[model samples]
Target chain A: MTGTGGRARYLWLGGLVAICLGLLALAAWQLVVLERQMRIAATENMIWVFGQTQIEALNLALALSDEAALQQIQTRFDILVSRLTLLEDGPQRRFLENAGVSETLARWRSGLLALDPAQGADPAALRAHVTALVAALRTKASLVMSHEWQSQATRLDSLRHLHLLALMSVLGAAVAGLGLVAILIDRERRLMSGQLDHLRAEKLASDLERERETSENHRRFADLIAHQFRTPLAVIDSAMHRLTRRSGGPVPPELISEKAAVSREAVARLVKLTDTALMMSRLERDAVLPSLRAHDLNDLVSSVIDDLMATAWDRDPARIRQSVQTEPTVALCDPMLTAEILSNLLRNALLYSPPDCRVDVSVFQSRDCIVCRIEDRGRGMSPEEIECAFDRFYRGSGHETLPGSGLGLTLARDLARIQGGDVTLSQRDGGGLTAALYLPKDDVA
Target chain B: MSLRYHIVQTALMTALVFMAVPAAAEDVLLTLTGAVTDGRVEMTRADFDTMDWHEFSTSTSVTDGRPEFRGVLMRDALAHAGAEGSSVRATALNDYVVDIPVEDFHRFDVLAALYMDDVPLTPRDKGPVWIVYPRDNHGVLADIRYDMRWVWQLVALHVQ
Candidate 1:
């Protein structure tokens, strides 16, 4: 319904309907005309009676010539009179009057009535009277016949015209019907082509959008690699420089050891940054495949905490308070991915908070989901930071001083989602940050 | 002697009144000649009067005004003559002839009319007997075929 095709379809359909209605009207009119034509009061009915009168008159004259009996002649005369009476009365009389034969016809009727066969009138006189009257009736019959012919011809002519008009209407309707079909076909083709063009445009737009997003991801990755590698490289270079400067003097063992530890820590930071960057790209490309299953949340959380503490030089049990609010703390997730996500959140809590301040870790059911809540005694993120905290390489301004790859929260959320779970950061109940990892609970337990 | 003559005249008039109209009913107004197993059957006006009568009102094409007709069903007349045929050719007194299918007698309540509005028809009129169809009662009887079957001044029915 878009263009000239739509308008043309309407025009064709409307014209077809109009033609059909016209055909119906013509059919009704034809029925009326045919009914009129089928009438008994036709010119032919009067013409037949007129011709019969002439025949009867001739028979009467013939009977007189043949010397027929009085009773026989009277019967013939009676039949003739009956034919004249048919002309004298009813709708036929009106027609005869119009044909200009009324005066002569009335005279003929009176003359025929004058004859009386039963009385035995003179033969010669009866012959003369019958002959003269027959001649007059002949003239009137001619007049009636001529008028009947003219009327019949006129009727046939009008009927022919009516037939021609009906035929023309039917022909016009057929042409319009064909035209309507052709227009419908053309409209269907145009609509199909239009739909194909629309689909092609949609595909083109989506391809362009995907390409822009991919190029943007590549650009961000390049900046992240440059910035993150440079800081760690500079620290490692500084450590190497300090060792080389002591190389020419009495190199104290403590100084060498301190420099070695500094160089190793920077190398470890670079390694972590490389791993985080690799994880970010893999997750973006949908390449991270996790084997998901039901797991005990308590086991996952405790293992992550144990592994994190084993890697810490000043690890203390008092630094983190653990609580399990449900007996069977089962969550449906990939065990390895869940451990990685929990390790990231707990490590962030310990690293960001003051050393003496204790962190709280709790496992409980929040409705149908199992939540591992990590609360830290550290300043929480602003709403803006929380909004984009899961965007790859998105770190808050003050977080630049902390030892982090800025991909921890993003990878943790991405991995958790892959296992049908999610991680969110919010302001804590007190004066810290809360990181909650939610997973679908295993109903079997 | 004059009182005896008056009594005799009175007796004659009373006898005529007690019987049906036998004055003009003696004439053989209609004759059925063909396909009658019992040979030609001649129907006088009194013969039509004695038969069971059917009545109907109808408008005619030739005549103006609707007229009520009193007559016997043509089927009853055909049955009385022991007539058996598919059709009958009715010959008018003026030699006008038209063939009518016998089925028409049973299909419509067709009448061989002896009277129109209580007046007996004569040859000077369109009947001594005229064939009339119940055109007003049946719409299909208004058709031209049935109209042609409304044979007037009908003198003879030759069943063929």
Candidate 2:
């Protein structure tokens, strides 16, 4: 969602790569050390030098008379001595010491001392010395061989251990890298799904709002037609009544009979207005598209009352009372539409009543529907006003100054009927209005 | 003048007899000179056999394997010669010379070997008196310097 989170993910991945690279570098360093050790093993050991010394001594004994041969033999001995010097000290001596062969090496040196070429010059003496030297060299060579074997074995073992450690570290880095990747991918997937859910929720809310607007328009058009016809029909009916009551008018009986017939037709037209209103009300009820599910009416009433207390004009929670007589009243209704209906009724009660006077709400169960009643200690509506309350845009006389769109009662009744419910406004004996909303009970089967 | 000639001839014959008689009697195998407070030690092979002997088995450059050497110790020989010196210069019959610190005689069982593996040594065998160090017994004597001191056919020690 933010650069910070993305940056943290990259940082984690970078750290994993760095760890792997560090392990690889360690492996490379070990290899370099191993190469150096191998070089020491190859160039500095005395076994082969002693072998060369043996060959040179044999040659010296065989060619004792030749000056050039003697020089070559001397040179070979010098070379052997130089190689032996490597074993006398430094890392090679330390290696021999660690291998428990230093004493043996010292003894070999002692034998070499006895076999020095300067000791005798005669061929017979030289041959005897060379013979002894060969035996000593052989013994010394074997000692060196076994010592080298042990030292090399030790070195190889440590090298293997270092390699194993490097391999395990590399593997650990790999697993950690994979784990980080998996966690990041999973988080990304969850974030994408969350975004999708948010978009879907927005689309559903908009769809519901659009459908509600279309339904409201249909109901408003029908109410407009009914209201427009009611006025003309009322005027015709009043005029007939006025004419029928007039006495001493200079008119024939037949004329009076014709006026009476005109009055009856006008009254019938007024009755048709009531029929038109009923037909429109049915149309409004039928317009309801119920996506029904089981819900609790008591919880709905409590929640709507709470909402009204907060949002309704001139409403205070302290002045409102609630009681769920049915307790856990379950109903088969669309919860959203049911909540809308209860909210409308509760809002009207809290708005119309005096600020200090209490508005009371109660939820009770009927045989087929659960009913919630919102009663307020306000000026009660007349019977005619109560009958016309369901008509869209119908504001009662002397109530035109009220802060409402006059669609509250109309929407309330329309929403109620759609959810297999109904709403009615009645006068309380104590001078208040009570609006009842009925919701169909949930079917257990 | 005839009397003088007769006298000189008798002296020459006597000198010849004396020189010839000792050569037939004994051979001098080793000569020790220089810095001996007691005087020079000229020992023949028979004289060396008469001295107290020490023995050790050791590998030598002139021989195969370890051979038991029987001889007088150099330290004892030096003492017999009443030698006073810090160092001994040993010369092989081939004239290869090496300076051997007296400490070597004290520190190691060095033998002026007359017999190797119970056999009397000859010049061809790197004897009559081979300077031998018990190399097998002492690891410190195992070096080129010490090896050079093991002079074969050792003819003289000039202790100085």
Candidate 3:
């Protein structure tokens, strides 16, 4: 298509241009012809000139018969010479020469000029000489008139043929130009359609890639759910079974209380896992509607930190450090969603780093938003891991022993978005991951 | 055949020369008859010379070179006879004839040229009175339609 289609277009364009040039040349030629016709540059009516010469010769003969005045006779003779002069020069000379009458016309001119008034000839001899010239003049005039007539007819015929040729060329140029325009328009339409098809193909390819990635994520999520929930559920089942059995007779009061405590602890773990799953499902179905308002971001962060310390036996308050860019760090967001987002980051920081290392939590006010950054002194993940940190069921590779449902970061991001905010994680400068929570700036505050 | 016909035609025309002898007699080179209130008006070289003369230079179809011409306008010439009509029939010494619209007389100062380069016109050199148009001034005059109107060796004007 490239070779043949491109060549054909060039050929069509070249041919049209050539035809237009030819038409222009023809038009210029026609203008020249019309100019020649308009100028009246060639007005020698040869037939009339020839007939006048013979007529004037005879006019002298008539004057001679009337015994007219000498001056009148001389004038008539002079007039005859003037008429013959027409046959002797210019365009008329060329015509008579073509007729092989130049010699005869020259001879007549000499003979007539010889009879000039300066010679003072008598009337009789003058009459005889004019009578002689008239006889020969009569013979040549008919021949010349016929020659002029035939040439005029041929000229007219050829002029008609020229006009026909010019008309056909004009029509040819018009058709060629129109054909060129049609081809260009059609080519433009085809090129646009081809571009649209290419764009559609690209979109389809990207859509297939995204679908495969999502299916892979679902397969990993299935395995994670089985491994994470099976342990807690199995512990609760065994403890309940031991307490309800009658084959061991009445169990000791101490053993019964201890077994009951173990069962209750496992039940709490199961409840936490169930709560995380329920919250994720609610976010996925777009069921959670956040109530937006201006709240102090620092208040939410410090409250989340307090709750984490109270819940875990090993999480020490002295191991955490807090900083604030402004007095309150105010931002526009739902208070509940902001607290949930902050708690997830604080808990992850406490769980991953060594128990003795201090965790840093900072709240700052940027130009358009309030940002809370929680930095931990744990081994930081790679760029690739950080990028996928917000995916459902995602966990750091080496932190499998850490207590987490793996839905923390994903839930945090979803809840923040519902409140018109977002969360991002990055590798800290020294040796840990930094999680940043952003909320819209509180203009009223 | 054309020669014999021309001879008889010339004899008849000479016999019918309009019998216009007047005070100028042999000097009378042109005549006006028919539709002239004076019945017949003969114009000699002297008669033309006495009229108000105008000069215009132009090249003619029958000749080679540009020549200056002096003449009285046809309207002025016809006024001598008090001639009136829509057009006039012009005849040459060779019996060449063409109709000139009366509008031509007033429209373009159509001249009955009596002199070439200040020389009195004799009958031999497109003279006595040749009908000259101001060809150089008007592009319309440089065409065959006007070419035929430039009658030479002119003899009579029958106003009608």
Candidate 4:
């Protein structure tokens, strides 16, 4: 795989490991806490049972001077002592030893047994002995309880330390994982940036190839046009020279006039062809950049109609009727290009229609665009002609009487596209043709 | 009723009342003397073997002497005395009295002994009758209070 993808995988794995480790540490800490709690509970229970039993024995000793009571108390005390002895030798033995509880119990027992009812002379002595015994027992019980409490505290402290260590280790692992991820991300970013630079270099090379192809196509077109016109110009020059240098001084006037007229018509035809070629070239170059500006589309349409009125009137004065069929709208475009587009449509309308046929020019705003329609009430174009209207240098076969170059609609479509607009010709449903120009509103432009 | 007839009825009633007194009311009484030197007491081997006495042993210990004891338990003694009450008041001849909790007797062995070191004890030696326990049997009975299983003398046991 690519370096960036590899690094991403590494980062994902690290994050997953970190998460698992974190959960494991949390579980371990929880277990430790639970175990510590259980230990404390057990210790507390043992201490409580031992204390209660001791108290009962003390009360029994005080109540019964019978030797049997003492014996029974001693027996019960021995069991407690054995348990305590086992505890002393176990994990918490140091705590019990430090409390000095066993010795205290031993001393209390000795004191009680040493008391003599016969030698006491007064009840006070016996009471004192009982009091001493009780006090001693209390001391032993308190010591055992305190030792247990201290052992619990120690265990708690140890548990806290263990938890803290676990937390620190987990944190350390997380930090390490984060560091790895950061490194991986940085590496991935570097790789992606390198890839982007490579792609940009490739794009620049591709752009250079396209520009080279465009220049070659232009060169080939210019060469073909220059070669085609050179022979015609040579023929015209030769004919003119021969006419000027004739040996017979007097020539036939009819032949001279006819030849001169023919020559003049040929030259004119050549000029027109040259002009069409130049116009096509200009349109092609203008595809790269158009002279865009805010202009009233209604005024543009009106001006084109006025320019074409003479031609339309020559066909049939009544057929040249025009009307603005829509509200005034402004559009962002080249005015020359707009006029050219409208003139072509109007001229076509006049050429194809019979006398008294009307043509309409109108403009309006639709949503965020300006729409201009040129409707001709004349012989409409066929579906095939309408579909191919915007193709370069295409002339319909039915337009034999019309004197026109087929580049008009093509130039208009190119201009519209450059200005972020479009032009379309559709056969009217009833009759004639409708050419619609859609231009972006000035604000949208 | 005549005075002689009244005297006769009172004599008869008196004689009948005397007949109702228990034989134990006429038994010989023994008094205890001197301090109990041994931290614990137990039955003499002789008394333990000969008498058909109530007996029991407990693993628990008294705080007066040593950690352990093996002897006739206090509950057995109280049971033999037909103790009807919840309390046992044990008094020495010198009026040294201690109230023995009845519940304690049920829990551990507390014995009255007449011997120590396998010999009959003398009064001067804090014996003739003493309460003793086998202190070496368990470590819990090592306390000095278990040692207070008084030795020198033990007298009346009153159940209340």
Q: In model 1, which residue pairs have backbone atoms overlapping below 3 Å? A: none
Model 1's chain B yields a TM-score of 0.82
Model 1 C-alpha lDDT per residue in residues A192-238, reported as the tens digit of each score: 99999999999999999999988987887787778878887898899
Q: Which stretches of candidate 4 lie over 4 Å from their true place?
A: A1-24, A27-100, A103-157, A183-335, A346-385, A391-407, A414-422, A428-445, B1-160
The lDDT ranking, best first, is 1, 3, 2, 4
TM-score of each: 0.66, 0.33, 0.59, 0.44
TM-score of 2: 0.33
DockQ: which candidate is best? 1
lDDT of 4 by residue, A214-255 (tens): 787567556645654565576567667767778887767865
Q: Model 3 - which docking category?
A: incorrect
Every model's DockQ, to 2 decimals?
Answer: 0.25, 0.02, 0.18, 0.02
Better of 1 and 4 by DockQ: 1
Q: Write the per-residue lDDT of candidate 4 for residues B67-134, one digit (tens) a residue.
A: 22223455555443345567656664333467666655554455665433343333322233445544
Q: Please tell me which predicted candidate would have the highest TM-score against the true structure.
A: 1
lDDT of 3 at A297: 84
lDDT (Cα, 0-100) at A26 in candidate 1: 85
Q: Which stretches of candidate 2 lie over 4 Å from their true place?
A: A1-47, A65-73, A86-89, A95-127, A225-445, B1-160
Instruction: Tell me how many clashing residue pairs each candidate has.
Output: 0, 2, 1, 63
Q: Model 3, range B1-160, lDDT digits (tens) per residue? A: 5366346434432322222122243577788988897778988877777889998999777555777898899899998878978888999876779998889878897889877777555554466688999988887788888888888778999998
TM-score of chain B of 2: 0.80
